[model samples]
Target chain A: MDILLALVVAVLLVVGGLFALLAAIGIVRLPDVYTRMHAASKAGTVGSSLMLVAAGLHSGEFATFARAFAGVVFFILTAPVAAHLVAKAAHQAGYRLSRGAVCDDMRDKAKN
Target chain B: MPSAEEKRQRTGLVLPTGFAGLWLLLFCLWLIFNSSLALPILATGVVAATALAWIFTTRSTVWHYVRLTPRTLYHFLAYTGVFFVELVKANVNMLRYVYSPRIDIRPGIVKIRMRLRSPIGRLALANSIALTPGSLVMDVEDDALYVHWLDVRTTDIDEASEMIAGPFEKHLGRVFG
Candidate 1:
């Protein structure tokens, strides 16, 4: 049981760390702010949530696990909302998409 | 379509059910935060949850129409399963883009129709999309959501609606709408 628990913790931590790393790389590599928001919001949220869960599981106490789970829930609920507000503000501020962007329906409709 | 508050009034649960649901949720949240069964904490949890629940459910119209039931609970559990699966898929999708030798993505802001009439449902749908694979919602106008697709598969509004919002709409419809 101890070996199994340790293995699970190790895997979660490693994977979570890798996701955070990926989010960082994406922020550096992705073309524009919008695409980069994708990296920051989705991967960053999951990576942190995983670490929270791993910490919760590692504690082996129901109360500790529950607290950590609440933290994860808090992140999941708030991160997307924050990201949406930032995206909306950026779009409204006239931050344009990159050259690779295929369509801009929001802008097109506003013009029409 | 009637608003959620109107529906709640029509369904005849504007007071007791809504207040009780809010109280229960707030209390659970309180317990989770405190994470203790000690007497003082329990007493404070009860007092705080009730006070907050009353203020929100009665003193303000912001969440006066909220409803919770076993069916909603079941749907919530189901939604959690769906959410985690999509979350993993989202991570994998990012991996494909992040590690590639050449970046190949056709990002776009495409409009998708909103089927869920309730405001809470629409909010949930938008959040789900923002977190899931391939799409990030940029703005929400009446009955339509403008989403920035990391990969633009198609430009047709109906197809995009079917693809992007369809998975979440079914579950959220039952819970919020």
Candidate 2:
């Protein structure tokens, strides 16, 4: 049972670490600010949450679970708010989506 | 000018009382979980948790509604379960690509509209998008969400919307709306 628990922890940690790395690469390599934000927000939120869960599993205690649960809740609540704020700021600064993009709602608003 | 009763309702919860209540709750929780709390320490813990919960929960007028219902409880559980599964899957996939030497990645931004109307729903949607792998939400305006993607696996906006909007917005609509 302990071995099984350890295996689970190892898997979670490895997976969480990998996602964090993906998020970083996406942030660095993505062509534009908008794209980079996408990478960071999606990858980062999931990565951190997984890491928290892994920590909780490894600890295998109620207190650890509660703390990890709190972290997960906080991550869920804050990540999107931060992303929305960033995107809103970027859009206000006149960051245009790539051309040949089929629909342009923000552009249309500018026309009106 | 204000009536005494109105004032009583408004300022009824003084700081000390509030903190004491919070501390009490925490002490109780500690006792329940830890299975041992001496009287003096329990008193101290009670005072602390109550104070903290009061200060923490009362931080913003943004949280206007406090009512809970069966539907809301259901929504909460559903949201947690879905988010947990997605979080695990995204983490595993992200690790694989990141560790790979070739680093096969295609990145871009996609703008899409959200169906959620309430501030809470919009917030939840944005957060969920950010939480998922391969996507990040950069902005939300009215009904729209501007997202950045680590990979443009498909250009179909509908598909992307389905991936995002289905689980989260449905629950948000139930909770906030």
Candidate 3:
């Protein structure tokens, strides 16, 4: 049981770390802020949340797990709202999409 | 407008009805955060929960609408399942996009309409789409939501709405709408 639990923790930590790494790589590699927001909000949230759950599970206590789960809940609920606000602000501030983007339907609506 | 005394009486009437449940929730949250049942903590938790619940009841009518029926509970669970599945799929897609040798994505903004009536329901829909990979909600105006699609597969409003916010809408509608 101890070994199995350790293995689970190790996997969660590694996977979580990999996701965070990917999110960082994405932030550097992506063409524009919007795409970067996607990386940060989606992968980044999962990364931190998984690590939190792993830390909780390592303790092997229900209260610790519940608190960690609450953290996860808070992360998911807020990440998107933050991302949406940033995206809206960027758009409002006239930070247009990179040249790689093919379409922007909001362009006309945003103007008038 | 009502007089100050009338307003006070009205608020007093509203406070007690919603006070207990909110206080219980807040007290439970306090216990979880403290991770203890010590006497001092319990005493403080009770006081803090009561104070916060009283203030909240006096200031807002939002929590009063939250009905805790079994159907809502069931829908909330269903929404959680949908959310986890989407979260996994989101990361898998992100892994592919982030790890690919040369990035090729047709990113664009598309319009989608929300059917949920309540502001909370619409907010939930927006968050669900934004959390999922390949889509981020940029703005919500009236019944319309503008989403930044990482890969612009379709531009039709109805099609995009069905594809992006479809799964969450049904479950959140039951809970919040």
Cα-based lDDT at residue A98, candidate 3: 89
Q: Order the candidate numbers by TM-score, best to worst.
A: 1, 3, 2
Query: How many times do residue backbones clash in model 1?
Result: 0
The C-alpha stretches of model 2 lying farther than 4 A from their native spots are A96-104, B1-61, B86-117, B133-135, B143-163
Candidate 2 docking: what grade? acceptable
lDDT-wise, the better of 1 and 3 is 3
State the weakest 10-residue window (summed lDDT) of model 3 chain A.
A102-111
Q: What fraction of the reference structure's interface contacts does model 3 contain? A: 0.84
Please report, as a residue range, the 10-residue window in candidate 2 chain A with the lowest summed lDDT: A98-107
Candidates' chain A TM-scores = 0.97, 0.91, 0.97
Residue B112's C-alpha lDDT in candidate 2? 72
How many angstroms is residue A78 displaced in model 1 relative to the true structure, after the best TM-score fit? Answer: 0.8
**Residue-wise lDDT of candidate 2 within B1-177, one digit each (tens)?**
135346668989434223433445466666655445578777766666766667754674323332256988799789878877876666666666555677666655566767766665566666776766666676566666766666666556688777666667777777766
**How well is each residue in B1-177 modelled by candidate 1, as lDDT tens digits?**
146568687887554336777788888988888888899999998899888887776655545434577887788779878888998999999989987988799998999998887666777888899899978888888898999999999999999999998888777887877
Tell me how large the interface RMSD of candidate 3 is. 1.0
Which portions of model 3 miss their true places by more than 4 Å? B1-12, B16-21
Kindly list the per-residue Cα lDDT of model 3 for residues B60-156, writing each as its tens digit. 7655545577999899999989988998999999899889999988899988998988766777788889888689999878889889999988888
Indicate the TM-score of model 1: 0.92
